[model samples]
Target chain A: MGHIVEKVQEYLERIERSSINAYIHVDRERVLKEAENLEKNEKLKKRPLYGKVIAVKSNINVKGYLVSCASKTLENYISPYDATVIKRIKSQGGLIIGMTNMDEFACGSSGETSYYGPTKNPRAEDRIPGGSSSGSAAAVSAHLCDMALGSDTGGSIRNPASHCGVVGFKPSYGVVSRQGLCDLAMSFDQIGPLTGSARDALLLTNIIKGRDFSDSTTVDTPEFKVWDEEEMKNFKIGVIKEFMEVSDERIRERVERAIEVFRDLNWEVVELSYRYIDLALPTYYLINYVEFFSATRRYDGRRYGYPIEEVCGEEVLRRIMIGRHISKKEYSGKYYKRALQARRMMKREMLKLFKDVDAIVSPTVPKLPHKIGEKLTPMEMYAYDVLTVPANLCGMCAGVVRCGEINGIPVGLQIMGKPFEDEKVLNIMIGFEENF
Target chain B: MVDREKVEREAEEIVKRFSQILEKYTFEEAEEYYILEIKNVLREDEEPSVDPSFREEVLKIAPKTRDGYIVVEKSRWE
Candidate 1:
């Protein structure tokens, strides 16, 4: 317990000295108190995540802490109550270190859009940490915390994890409760864990997942299965051709190396393609705009910190305006409805592919993360999500594992499985990690 | 007199622009698409229990309050 407390204190000091701007708020007193309490209580020692320090993305509420979502709209807003995941983590003796930064309102793909300042990639100081779960990924990679909770909407968790070289897992939508997460796009959002390893991610997922009355979207999910190395050879893995086509040659090479490892293990590697793969980004953004607009209606300047339109960053404003335009009564059927239809098409395609394979694999991001402060158009930034949005669009489970490195920067191999097959997807990730 | 032809032409233009955006995602041509079965989960009809201090707690964070109620700027004519 004493050693764990010392480690927690050391992390606090490291966070203080960190230049990445990974954390938006650090409640040092609260962190120390929790650590001291854990040291005193022998009963807490039996908990699975006992004395583990966990950083939470700013979008998820931690009672009495500022859940700014890395935006001025909620910059000073103290959460009124603990989110369900926060309650679960605390119960398991996980120490809540602080709230980490993210893209403002989780609207952007790069951490650079954060109002607090972009979270620099710890792996490459000059490169951007892919976002909107940027800070959580950066913190985990930098070892400022043992694990972090991040929300994924269109690759937010996995994207940053890929850039920072850590494990990020987005459980199937509705598997983990979304009650306290500030919605970026409710239909696409899932609160997930980013950790240093695949097994740690599974441990956090086990604690945070289950049916929650507070979030009716939650369903009765099966418990996470322990990894069985013997079962690894029996599964078929699909490599999406479209994903490979869009990725940089270096990234593709790294991902192919990972696939080759699986092949050597006697797992059959199949080439698959989806005709609508190119449409995933547009479809994802369209739904994101509409849902984010609907969700942010509560920020009317009275109940929250400020009117969102006036205080939010540019990317957020762009989405809201686009949402407003698309959701107009006369335009809804043409844009919003069509996007939903496209979503359905994507889900169907993924379902068909899953019938022939245990899981699909791809590069987590099509290219290496751009240099921090790079001037990229919104569309260019959106392109970063091309390979990762399919999992969110189809409401399937996805996990990213550090596969290989290029130019000294780490790349991730993405594994996606059918909805509610989170355990299988994670087990496959663990197997890959072990093999690599 | 209402310009019927002009109005129809403008409406057509708007539809054309919207269609172009949808086309970018291949949604304009998608014929077969799945619609999820959305069933509303209704709670039992009963008087809801409330905490006695709930209102006070909510008001604590409201930007403006008057006479124990949230206050807002007038946005419409009576």
Candidate 2:
């Protein structure tokens, strides 16, 4: 009991003196009150997440806390209710530490888009924390919280996890509920965890994943195959040829080093190619623009804090305008519809490739994190998500683990598995952690 | 309107590149495939259950509220 109280106080003090800008809100009074109550209750002490401090990304709803989405449009608004995941976490006695900063509306790949300020990578102080889920990953990396909740729309979770050198898992789409999460692209949005280790991610995932009456997209949890040392020897791993072609040589060397870990264990490693991989970025962005524009229409200065169009950052405005153009009655079939077709093709291509391999391995990001406030074109920024978005496009489970370092900066190796094969992906990550 | 024009120019460049890449593959004229197969989950028809306090919490977050309801300006047509 004393241990939990001491830990919470320690984190709160560190947060006060820190300049990473990882957290946007931390109520010292409420956090201590919750910790004290947990100390008093013997029954709560038996729960799995008892007294574990969790940092939540600002976009997710936590009752009475700000769910600002890192945008001025909802800056002053407090969450009216708990998200389904938050409810589940609380039921297991997990303490909500505070809401962390993020790329405003989860729209940018770099952490610099937040209205609050950019989150500096704790691991590499001058570099950007790869984002959308920037603060969640940085908080875990900095030891400000035990574990954190992050949402992945298109590589948001995995990208930052790579840059910040932590474990990030995007569960198979629809396995986790999205009832109270603010939408980025409804079809692709998934709430996941960024943690210090793979096992912690698995523990938190099992707690929050199941059928939810409120989120119609929720599905029954799938049965996971427990791993045996001898049985794992037979697993076949694939390295995507297209992903490697675009990666910086330094990142590729780190990926190859990770592949060597699998080979040394008598696991088969092969190269597989999917032709439509080049189309992933355009397809992903076209759909996201349309859906994000649709979702922002509700913020018209009536119900929410202010009008999004008037208050959002540049990237958010660009997506809205692009979406508006594509959605015109005459432009429909030319852009959005073709992107949907390309999406279907990408999914089919992946399903076919998965039949030959248990999982695919690659560098999580093609390049290392750049310095904060670096000048980059929109297309250049979009390239950071190229390797990670394919997993989301195909509705597959993917996770990132710190494999090695390049120039003293951490590099992540991404493991992607077939849909509903989240356990296998985590098992591969765990195996990598043990051996490397 | 100037911002819109710049946005349009940027959109054109992006669209042109995307179209070129998409043209490399031949797509079938089939219905778009959805990832999940489940249809909408319908609730049983019964008298609605409401939490009265929820309304108050919702109204509290609104930019404008009056007399226990959210307030909005009249539309341009009105």
Candidate 3:
């Protein structure tokens, strides 16, 4: 345990931890205590993530540990039980370094509105790390831990991962149980990994994911075949036209270059249109508002102790208000139902689209990171999630790969596959990395 | 006059929705605070929107209207 603590401390200094503020708290005492046993007294457990040090997003419960959702309301509250993912990670020998910071209630696309303060991009501290999984993204970029776990509810995880120039994966919904997730649009939320490499990502996901009884929504992945060197010869890939059109010209160019790499690998690009993706954000926010209004009743100041209404930051408050207005009596189904129908329509369209392409590839975020603490015009920040949110809304397995650099900061290419075909999507990614 | 109770009910639903996005609040309290705040907004708001017809609409919904707006019984908060 002491050895792990020393190693974690060494990583802290090496990563220049002071600048990023990725973690809300690092539980050195628990981690080190566990590490001591693993080193001298503990027997080797046949765990894939054994001896690996990973961080958890503040949203996930860590059992008797503080799991602040980066809000002052949750600041003093400690989790009484482990979230399913946290339990799996610990059982598999992955050590929890600490809970990483995030946007209050995972409301914003950019990491700026965290009550604990925004986490800066380790690649470029001057810029905002895309969020609400801002701290998880920065932690890997800084190598503070091997990788971190983050929740993606409308692109929170992938947006940050892309801006930070690291790999982020959002498994098909229900693949990773939501048993312990601090519900953010529960239907849209999924626990996923943010790692330095696709290899590490696969290792962590395989451990934490599976059908758990605790999460009634979870189901098993079907017999998905992995693409071996031989099978890679004839698989087709699709590029959503609207998604490829970057809001920034340079990001568009970067994506084109990454596309060329696929061309070099003899992969065919299937041009397709997913116009419904354009409505993804509005629909998402609508559904989120309705669902969030329903979900938050558990925190009535009496049971949860803190009043989220008083302590939660502005972004959260805005969503609450927006959701409130949309949920009026006659308007009940007007916004929320329409959004769900849109989600259904998009998912149905993509189901057909995925039939033709082995995976869909696009730039994760259309732009790179913006300056830290910079007041972003709301629309501008919202654009960061444009490329990623559609997948969440559509219930697809999506991942981001660091493709190239823009002014020394890394940009990522997003690859999404059919629902429940997370393994298929990841295998293709791993195959691409083998070529690299 | 707009009943604060109606607004409170709406606010409860709003807080309930906000809780979904955040899940920070438990189900009961979120519902309570939400409803109460909405009632408060109704109570304090002389007018809710900037639309020109808002005053007219209030008068139409209310028991009476004088001039361009609802002619409600005066209250301490108002």
Which candidate has the highest lDDT of all? 2
Please state how well chain A of candidate 2 matches the true chain A, as a TM-score: 0.98
TM-score of chain B of each: 0.46, 0.63, 0.29
Tell me the deviation in Å of residue A233 in model 1: 3.4
lDDT of 3 by residue, A1-436 (tens): 3666577667656555467889888766676677766555354456667778888889898865677788876776677667888888877777888889898888887788888888888888888888989999999998888889999988887888888988899998768889988887877899999998888788788888887767777776553444567867767889888887655788878877877777878879779888665565565667777778777655544434365766666666666666667778876555565566666666667778887888999888877787877766444666677788778777788988887888988888888988777987887777766664
- In model 2, which residue pairs have backbone atoms overlapping below 3 Å? none
lDDT of 2 by residue, A242-361 (tens): 899999999999999989999988889999998776899988888888888899888888887988888778788888888888888798787788888888888888889899898999
TM-score of each: 0.92, 0.96, 0.82
How well is each residue in A1-436 modelled by candidate 1, as lDDT tens digits?
Answer: 5977899899999999999999999988888887998888888789998989999999998977889888888876888777999999989889899999999989888898888999999999999989999999999999999999999989999999999999999999888999988898888889999999999999999999997877777877776877677866578999888889989999999998889878878889999988777667767877787888899988878775898877776677767777777889998877778878888877887799999999999999999988998888667888898888889888899999999898879999999999889999999988888889
Candidate 2 stretches with Cα past 4 Å from truth are A222-226, B1-8, B29-33, B44-52, B76-78
lDDT of the candidates, in the order given: 0.86, 0.89, 0.74
Model 2 has a clash total of: 0
The better candidate by TM-score, 1 or 2, is 2
Question: Would you list the rank order by TM-score, best first?
Answer: 2, 1, 3
Model 3, B45-77: lDDT tens digits are 364445464344334333345675544434345
